[model samples]
Target: MHRKTIVDVGTDHGLLAIGLALTGKFQKVIGVDVSQQALENGALSLLSQIESRRKGIDPQKAALDVPVEFRHGDGLKALEEGEADIVCMAGMGVSTLLQILEQDHDALTSDLNRRQYTDLILQPTNSKPRNLMFLYKSLQDSGWELRNERIVKLSSRWYVTSHFTRPQSNIPVTALIEDGAMKIPGSTLDCTLSDSDPMRQDLEEYCRHHSQWIRKDSEYGRMDLLEEVWLERFGNDR
Candidate 1:
């Protein structure tokens, strides 16, 4: 795996940061948290782990390693400009993630090369499906384009990772948006297939799921728009 600079936000115990550093996945890891005591305790724990590892290896065989830093501050507040390439915000809620984005939006937009910041890996707790949509939309509006997504099943809940990049103007139109969403003007569709065919099966499947969710009065109103799009695309097919 390629080495990358990693910043893990809300790093409580610093295990992930230490693990990444030990595995050589990252040259350096900065664990950021708002609580001073948490940072102090986490740093102590991380240092102990690093020392334990060093004791097992002969000095001649040991590789020089970068020390992990623990910073006490709000999300990205203590981080210097262009300090890291990957930002991992885990063990936080969607609302907290949005708040972080709002607070750091200007700094992130101005200092970082949006194209080079390869990923925003969020593992949000207490997130509704629509909150995910809202997050996706907000990133799009901020000039970041999602590149990949994955849903991992954890012991109790699902964790999602969304990797993004700054959109290139020359990329195909449909590649810029979500599967069931609309594209912005001047975006070119990447597919050679007819437009009608792209959403034919999607509409049918969405309707089936929407009807089920609607019957239960789920709080996700975006499903209504999905159902509407499905109906508009395949009215008589049902």
Candidate 2:
């Protein structure tokens, strides 16, 4: 069994970390941010959340003593080698996320990574298909296999949250990437949900330009379509 610890890198308000802690699935949650101010704010939020939960009627929820800590540092510099089983980098751009990983490759790309395995929850704020494709391609080339994928349109910006983990030795890297484009299933681009709004119009143009080369296949190219849930996933259902 593995240690059920999570390290939230670039955790802005620690909402995701707090939510994970509340689920009681993870034993510990660490919110790491570059800005000290952000850490302070998240600490306050965590404190307030705990206090509020303590006042609730659900004794079990209130009694949940999941530890949530905040650290101040850029990217993965605040993290030690194999410090957590899961690392989340959300609400960031594709380029910024890649830069962070590139800056601290050894810590994440260790032999321990293959043996112990680490889950990475990456949600990029970038809307351009080309950039997202680049990030996806980079992850594959670096031996991170996709476990889950989500496409969300939050307040005019489309976000793709890719959950990845250590590559299984048997499976080969993705061959879908071709001619700067591949197919991304269950997306506005794939399903043709294009509208005429100015922002979406711009995104639509880019999607059209790279439609052939930017492929984010459905849940690792699963055969059965789970249209009931709006997530595009791969690997295990969890």
Candidate 3:
């Protein structure tokens, strides 16, 4: 746990922000959403959780005193530069996430470059391979390196969660981007993944489950990522 301020983008219920606040890992947590209704609902839920979690404790040292704030706005537009140390956007489709990044590139890139916000956590709610790859490429091209990535199963569903950082962090690479699909130079997807790469297996599994979207779609990059990963991991070589 680190002493940092985290802004949870698209925080529908504010559960993640609240849970993190309870851990004492973060000093403050701000939840931002476009829908005022979601923010109100999340605020009510936070109040309920605070009331239930704070019995027999001094009002000054409550368990839920994590300084969680809720703001209504569209994505990063809700905050000023250097306002937060980290930004977490969960439960969004890759396409939707990409759109937000595209629209918020000015703010996002500025904060990341200034090292005001070091970590960006993106978890696409859906399992669309092409959209994920496109997002990966877009971020890489924009200078954010994928520092950590995980594929986890939750209640019979598998999702990919990625942690990106500016190159200033100097962290060793855990996820390798090899193998070209749409020519995003300097991308994690620029070369072929080696057997030692950790993401190989997860990419294979993701591709296997996403076979249903094999149909062509040019705007979305079609099945290029899916087929490439399939061929690289489970294809003729295997």
Best by lDDT: 3
lDDT of 2 by residue, 42-150 (tens): 6656667675767675666543475677788886777776677777888888888888876745643554363354777888776554466567666665566666655
What TM-score, to 2 decimals, does candidate 1 have?
Answer: 0.67
**Shift in Å, residue 186, candidate 3:** 17
Would you list the C-alpha lDDT of every candidate in the order shown?
0.59, 0.61, 0.65
Q: Tens digit of lDDT per residue, candidate 1, span 1-238? A: 6777888888888887767677766878888888888877776566666766776675543434645777888877777766888888877777788687567555434334532566677667743344555566556655566665544444645455566565443332234444544332111111322446643344344334434554455355445543333334433334
How far in Å is the alpha carbon of 212 misplaced in model 2? Answer: 11
**What does candidate 3's lDDT look like per residue over 66-184, in tens digits?**
57888898987788877888889899888788777656555445546664677788888875555566666567655677766666666857777778876443321222345332222
TM-score per candidate, chains pooled: 0.67, 0.65, 0.72
TM-score-superior candidate, 1 or 2 = 1
In model 1, what is the error at residue 25, expressed in angstroms? Answer: 2.7
Instruction: List residue ranges in candidate 1 displaced over 4 A.
Output: 1-3, 60-67, 105-118, 167-215, 218-238
In angstroms, give how far residue 208 of model 3 lies from its true place: 4.1
**Poorest 10 consecutive residues of model 1 by lDDT?**
184-193
Evaluate residue 71 in candidate 1 and report its C-alpha lDDT on the 0 to 100 scale.
82
Q: Candidate 3 — number of clashing residue pairs?
A: 4
